[model samples]
Target: MSKYIIIHVFVRIFSNMQENSKDPITQSNEQCSLTMVRRVAAMLDLDSKSFSEGDLLPKGWHFFMLAGETRKSELRSDGFPGLGVPIPDLGLPRLLLGGRTVSYNGDIVIGSVVEKTSFIKSIVEKTTNSGPMAIVTIQHELRPISETSPAIIETQTYILLSASKASNNSEKTLSQPIEAEHQKNIIPDETLIFQYSALGFNSHKIHLDRSYAQNSEGLPDLVVNGGLTTLLLTEYIRTNLGLEITDIKVKHIAPLYCNRPMTLTAKKSETDWKLYVYDNNNDIAVEAEINVK
Candidate 1:
């Protein structure tokens, strides 16, 4: 697909994006430095040895080191990384990825160094179709280590609530009665979880350590990275639809664990496609929309 066509589609998604326009955001930043990008290439199963650090980082690869960590070394029983930043103690224990928006300025080429400045854009207590929840919105801007122009900007929202909170995924369960126009069945394994964790610089033990996940966190299985599921959605559009994705926004609905049958489904709309991923239980794990004009 032509670049111009993708740009037009991105514009439409941006127009309908769920972002609050407010001011005086809490700000802090970290360097996209070190050989981190190299590790990122390994996580993606890409051979960066042949490519230099200054070379433009590939699309969909911009999600590296997005979660800047807290200096403290301890973690809550649920494993929310103690990134020194102050996350509101919403009095909630569990964390779910609500949604995210990646505004692609261009391929983020990490020169000798790069910088990512983040902002606590907003935090709202709201009632969703599911139940009561606290939504935390964080914004990240990526640019050259010494430049002012941004190569990319991402607005990521996290939802904090009780683990036992009700979800409609199980209530409206379907064995995929309607055949999807396009879909991919992927049974993710521990190896994919490990590699993706390595790629995204995610150190959450719930994702890497199976015993810790089940014993400590009280989870049935090792958790899958929300980012990886979102990546699958974009890849489905690219490889299956022959479209270039400039933006991706997703609201995770349920948890997806390893060794389960997970399927990605997409259906066509007027200018975009209704996208989703289903867990082994056949409940929607993620709810999303893709725009490819």
Candidate 2:
């Protein structure tokens, strides 16, 4: 059969799963709101044109978190290893992705609409085995405009730069100094690292499968994805930076492995805030700057 036919068949099978899932992500006190679900879906369906018309649930805007003027400026800065600057790109490290994560924290029952917002967190320039890399992050929050409790929606993202654009580096050791406004520790272990990798559906050898990563990627065991670290830092800002995060940007500096503990911090500058997911030994796992309303 043609690939399209196979895809159509798979779509039908997944439709049943959605129908069968009664309150897929259980709510604390109330039944899952159908109205809220529709609202989320509608927002996801909106486009740039509708966004220009007015507020349409803030969908595509989140994708811009990975690209912007600030991100471009930082890429051209001197902290990076290469003599020349790199291109500013968007989307996941893996282009064709499985959409964004929808971590259901609470349900906005049917007939209810929740307010949504997003923000750019921070940007960092780092030298990796592949050369200079940028990990941009965006934070999103979904809260009922009215009395909504025990149910909240939140997500942070990490985007990797294309490997081809990385400075041509045959050497694995990063030869650059990472400047930081704040200091943090990186304490990683098997359990925390493994759990995060699993939740993100990341099959990259550098994340799990230690032997392959060490032999092929030439890393210690398995290296952590900067995107996940940026997500964690973006989450920190959502919980602390008030309720008006509209965008976020983050960059990756160094690699973090399992069995290491790291410190996460957030700072503000005017309407923007910076978050750090830093490692004590290797320096920074990822640095993010968030824009708040």
Candidate 3:
């Protein structure tokens, strides 16, 4: 049978399953631990003593608290813990972080107990040029126990694809160097990748297992976590540019591998800031825009 016919039949079957199913929702509580904050700061080579109890948790730092409490047997075949809520088994094996949007409304203080609610916002299956794939959007809200409103709301988009679609090499041509007002270069090694993955409770083999990344995923090396790249950009804005961000939208354009030097650059405009992360090959890997107060 032709590929289109296969996709059509597959979608029809899944649509029937979806019609009988409901989106999953989950809720949990966690302490905004000062110890956890310090650990994350130390992971980034920052002064752990700089943070203390009652201090407002840094934006984007909530990633650590949003990790799913999935058990060993519940983890996906790729070692991914679902987005706090259960993810439907769509038969697509390879998963990628497509993008995320974060909105900061209130402040979450250290030492405070916060309630997190996560749910599947949407799931759409489609036929792509490459093959059949699905896009899943998961939304999470974190509210301080002492308050009535959520302090942080975030939506993460994940793309699921067939393993046969994995690529071992860059498919696009190298582009010209990107020029920005401020730029920093750093190499992401195994230690950094491992630390970030551990901090976020992300067991995705792409960021942790080299053999799985290479042989299974057809990647050159372990992939860097997209959330880590966003955290770096936000930290740069806060520490280097002295700006307070209110919102951020991030897009992962390409993958950045471990032990490779990636450049972080930011350009300030009248209203917002634009950030770009260039891989070792000088190609844009991540693009983001920050709205500051």
Q: Pick the TM-score winner.
A: 3
Shift of residue 169 alpha carbon in model 3, Å: 2.7
Candidate 2 residue lDDT tens string, 1-293: 44442211111111232245231222112222433333323332323232222133322222212222223334322112111112244322421111133343443434345454444333344454554444443334556556544234344434344523222122344434445554344465655555554433334555657775565445566566554565455445543443445555555566666766577766667766777665545355566666655
RMSD of each: 9.7, 17.4, 3.8
Candidate 2 TM-score to native: 0.41
How do the predictions measure up, each by TM-score?
Answer: 0.74, 0.41, 0.91
Residue pairs that clash (backbone atoms under 3 angstroms), model 1 = 69-83, 70-83, 70-84
**TM-score rank, highest first?**
3, 1, 2
In model 1, where do residues sit more than 4 Å from their true spots?
1-54, 72-74, 82-84, 110-112, 126-133, 145-147, 162-174, 215-218
Q: How accurate is candidate 1 locally (lDDT)?
A: 0.67
Judged by lDDT against the true structure, how good is candidate 2? 0.43
| Per-residue lDDT of candidate 3, residues 1-293 (tens digit) | 56554444233222322245465567789888998899899988999999999898887788898987789998889999876787768889889999999999999998899999887777788876778789888888999988988999998999898877376665456678768779999898999888888988999988999998888888988898999999988888888888888999999999999988899999987988888999987888899999999
For each candidate, what is the lDDT? Answer: 0.67, 0.43, 0.86
Best by lDDT: 3
Candidate 1 local Cα displacement, residue 189, angstroms: 1.1
Q: How much is the lDDT of residue 97 in candidate 1?
A: 74
Summing lDDT over every window of 10 consecutive residues in candidate 1, give the lowest-scoring window: 7-16
Runs with alpha carbons beyond 4 Å of true place in candidate 3? 1-22, 170-174
